[model samples]
Target: MPHKLSEIISWPEQREKAKTYFDSYGWPDNRNEAWKYTSLAHLKEGKFTASSDSAPIDSAQVIDSAAQLEGFYVEISGSAVQLPPQDALPNGISITDITADDNARAAAFTHLADNHLLPALSAMHQTSAIAIDIEKTDSAAPLPAVILNLTGSNKEGACYPFVIVRVHKGAEARIAEIHSSHAGLSCPLMVYEVADDAKLQHIRLQAEASYTTHLGLNQMQMGKNSQINSFAISMGGALSRLETHSLFLGSDAELAQSAIYLGRDRQHHDITSFVAHEIRDCASRQLIRGVLDDKARGVFQGKVRVAPDAQKTDGQQMSRALLLSRDAEADAKPELEIFADDVVCSHGATVGELDENLMFYLKSRGIAEEDARNMLIDAFLVDTLDEIEDPDFAAFMTSQINRWSLARR
Candidate 1:
């Protein structure tokens, strides 16, 4: 019965040694190394409770029913957590709502909940919270719209959560981490930290509910000429996993990793990223894309590491997949490990489908073979909305990917 959130929280022995190594290595059934390819033993054999002690949800109607990531400034509707004071943020900003007075934000949420596991299962089920701090200012604006609303509460196993974000030192920010799931078993976690010569732009949007289960973990620290541009977009979930861990730690640091996952039916989407350059002349770039239909299942794992003084390190990794059925399932793994030697690492992966001569040349231009396969699935999700260099957040993520490909055609 050891599951009242691992028996009343007293962890902090590095999360009780990673929850006693996942309780004697249980939940990774398809062989470890990041659960091989999505298997949490069917969500721990479904005894999945703990998500609804109800009440306290109305961050202005969950930011007016979510799905709006145009410009940010904290507007969550359900599980209520909204803000705008501090002379209405934005000039050398700092916004805190760490679940309001949890004994004065409980030491900044126990310094990111002491060795995380879904942010210590969302601070032992505290529900809604926010702590975004961004310093450094010498001009330039247009980077402030931190809206996080993980809605849920249609009651079936209700886990709607939040996290810790801090971006300081020579800071420049652009964040829009949005998620909306109004139907059961939903889980949400977001943790971010980017300091030193900082310039961060992270936009992760997962439009939820398909028997939702989203687990997101993003932790980054890159000093020196620091810069990070991360973008993740998963159109809906059933079992979505986004785990990104990065560390470059000073010296010409920079990273631009992108993602896009679109799944249908038995949806299971996974996008994993791990980038560690350690030090000295660092630069990294990773691109990931996926789209699976019908018997849906997609996973992309990317790893790029160049330590050993990371001399002149320049790393690149790519993953591409598009299977439109034939019992859809696509997996791509890109890896690169360079122990310096004046590093210049590379990685590649691809899985094919669609493009039957560009769908018979867009059905000979008459365009009605399901409208030329929904305009080639909206031009393959428009290269993840042009990596969102913010033209109004890439035209609102291209109108939410053409309204989720016209609601999956």
Candidate 2:
């Protein structure tokens, strides 16, 4: 396991800019309004040990489930990228390690957020990056999903990995990213680009060890007539934050973002989003659900901005949390900034304990007390899962939720 930063790095300009920005802000704290609800005071003295491509990993287990789903797969252990054979991958799909290509790295960086603190932190520590490209257009047949399994050593250090995904004009793609490791910290930065008339289905699974701190940044840009549906599950890590910044470049695009976060045993989870809808006739929706128990804390913060030119835009946001224990806490903030008069926009949040009436109803139907509690919990989370259009993807998320519930029992 390497614990030292690489002497030679790629994309120097981006790294220098990130370093400069991070130095100004340092480790994010409550003072930063964005980091108000979630604190990083515990990691103030922490240092990032960039993972190397020479690091060893168990190749067999990382992406077996993804492969079973007949999906294309990529595995990143440390900085080592294991790609499927070109011959095995479906047509119109390609994966490349772009660390050596300055132009490619610059192009990818241009499509992502530069001022955000998390991305700056991620950019400063990364020595390499990868990109996945989809080229098919006007196809009647559906494309195979792409899955990325990112893992790090079970050591007391951090790993920084950056990835870019591109869906070309009129193309459609489904992507799943999984983080499963025991490293003290994992920071994965991702940027997605959807061209005109393109579509993207993005799913994220953060299941790192309970001792790990997973901080991630995801930025996306959509062109005219494009659409993106995104879902995320956070059931691991001692402290985790998933922040997203989505920008609309043209009119007639849509975005649907939803997530479910589960925490217990002093864990802390934060899910944040900032969406910019500056084009007309576009729409954006946000839905977040959280379950907290045993002194755990969950936070959701989402903001939407509609410009004056963004007429006929529809934006909606809702965040709800169910606390299973009195010690647990939930915090939610949903905001909408609209300069457009003809747009429909709304935001709401609700945090509460499980319904005793519902529990009693299930118990009266001959269900055990513990079983009835579980039932209500599942029912509360099912609505989030129901929004998913793919049955297989929904089932995969259900398994993770069930595992979390089982552990609580």
Candidate 3:
């Protein structure tokens, strides 16, 4: 039986609009270019409803490794939102839970003006959101992490969670996106706005149960001279699709994105991103690596666009997947649409199994076959973590990967 939508949280106008769109256009399928690798034909028949109650979870009992690290955290289970106390936050930063105030809700929701399918579908469910704002700071040490943990229902239901992060001029912030176990039918959206001279370091860890389904999106808007460095690890969830959309509204901005994924036992993971350089002198790079075992499958679709007037724009993307078993599958599609005469953009993708020569060499050195394979796998994934600037975040991600590799053995 379908549960009821949460009554405590409501966004009447946007919910109605999303409902109308669903009634007319209907949900998209593989026919849509954006969803070519992932299909939603089965989701249309799901009996899940928006969650109707709040769940309070103990931080220590959470599954995601990021939640274990020290930080000011926000915990959300279903429609409930728990923000860090104001006194606990730094002087120049503030995070707040959304209320019924029309002006406040309207202002924070501007990021979804031209919404995507996942956000629109989330709107149909009871919506819960939080706003994060940071001002310029002169602290010598790096700012502490802000962990946003989204947990699913203990019962059978769905969850819709939203977050917005704003970095003021000349400021910087570090954020960690952590999802707990069993994020059932979850559709979450996050928006990051970086002003001129601002910076943001974002790291995400998705370690949910095998029965979970997670559909998520991250939108990035960059201004002149701003920068964003982000990394993510996807190792859980039965079906997971994460899409990142980046737009450069000003000149001289930089973006660096890197990710690692591990799939086993018939799991499905999809990562898709779109980066558009609408202005001049912007540079963006993306690096993705994954390891698959058993009958698991992985997909990566990356597209970069440069406008005619956007001179001196440079973008690069590369994706490589290492298959651990014959039954595992990997698919990649990389695209570049450049209308500018002076811009440079390129993309490349490759899928292959572990190196037999390396394995043979390791075995000749007296290492067991299983030990040699694990050693080679560790080396293949270790370099990816070098791209992460934050040591704590890197270690957290690596710890989870090691655990997963052990389980695979």
Candidate 4:
């Protein structure tokens, strides 16, 4: 059952504004360049409803599953969950519910009002938002990691979860955001603001069930001399798309992003990113890898724009895919638009299959053909996993890849 727009907890004015925006644009189809390859036919026909109602959850089960994981856990069953008390946090870290501050809510609404369909819908139907603020001093002490677990229900409706992260000047923090779902739809929006001289490490893992559909957007704003390192691992969902929009608001900002995606058995995974170097002396790098098996499909579309005034920009992007089966498909579209003459920009893409010579070499060494293939696949993904700064999180991601490989075998 779909809930009325009025049932969502948004300011009347903002809701109306978002509704007007959504009505004008409506849902994008193949005609939309960004969504040309991915189809939304099932979603459009399903008429999915957005709800804040919490489903029955086994807290113990969730806790046990994450007991070995390192970090402070913030769990979301269907909607956002409560965080620990302020006093329990570190000296410079604060987690505040967005609803507590009307100004924050309004600012968030404004930032997402004109976004794509999923983000606009998220702004209109989001029930709760959590803001994490980090303030680092010159003490050089390592800040604690924050983990967000977004779990979806088996119901047929959709749930929208929103998160806001701010790294104050001179602060350094690591955040791990994970998404797991059952048999429904999920649309999540995350915003990050990195102040001057701040450093943020973000690790995202999307491991939803095969029957789920996930559409997620991550919006980032980087200030002068700020740095953001992002590593994402996508291994689940029937139809999953993760889009990132990064804007360098000030000069000397840097961004390093890498992603690994695995698709099998008719699954579809898409990773799209648009990065803007709006100022001078900014640098950005992106590396994407995909592993497809059976009849699965993978897509990577990345674009880097250097403004006319944005001189001294260094940007590079690379996309590579490995197809395990003849029916598997991989598509890569790497583009660069440079308006400045003093910039260094490059983009490359490659799609290929397993090397038969390597397979034969391993087989001659007394390894089974399946074992050799799995070993080669794992070796191919090791570089991407190495990009992660956290050893624990990298280990976790590696485990996911191994699990996928073993299951397919």
Best by TM-score: 2
Query: Residues 1-409, candidate 1, lDDT per residue (tens digit)?
Result: 0111122333344335556555665455665566688876556876442221122223343345444654446654346666777676657777777665564334433333234455555555556667778777767655655666555546456564566677887777777776766545555666566777788877777876555567766666677887888777886757778878777768897888788888887788898877878787988887888888888889988877777888988888878888888988888777777787987887888888878899998788787787887778778779566766766566666766676776677
Give the per-residue lDDT of model 4 (tens digit) for 1-409. 0112132245666667778878887777888888888877777776442221213224344345445566677766666476877888878889887755656766664444254676677767775688989898666767888888887775586777788889999899788887876637878788888999999898888877666777888877899999998998887677888988888888999999999888887888999888888799999989899999888899998989888999999998989999999999998888788999999999999999989999999999999988898899989998677777767767777776776676667
Query: Cα miss at 141, model 4 (Å)?
Result: 2.2
Return the clash pairs for model 4, or none.
Answer: none
Q: 100 in model 4: Cα distance from truth in Å?
A: 5.8
In order of appearance, the predictions have TM-scores of: 0.32, 0.91, 0.90, 0.90
* Candidate 4 ranges with C-alpha deviation above 4 Å: 1-12, 47-66, 109-115
Quote the lDDT for 200 in model 2. Answer: 91
lDDT of 2: 0.81
In order of lDDT, best first, we have 2, 4, 3, 1
Give per-residue CA lDDT, model 2, range 1-409, as digits (tens).
0011123334677778788887887887888888999888767857432221112223243345445555877888767888888888778899998867777776677755655677677767774588999987456878888888888875677778888999999899889988886677888889899999999988898877667778888888899999999999987777888988888888999999899998887888999888888789999988999999888899999989888999999999999999999999999988788899999998899999988899889888999998898888888987788777766677777776776676678
Give the poorly placed runs of model 2, Cα more than 4 Å off: 1-10, 47-67, 137-139
Give lDDT tens digits, candidate 3, residues 320-400.
Answer: 999999998999998888999997787889999888999999999999998998999988888788888877877877787
Alpha carbon lDDT at 93, candidate 3: 79
Candidate with better TM-score, 1 vs 4: 4
Clashes of each: 10, 0, 0, 0
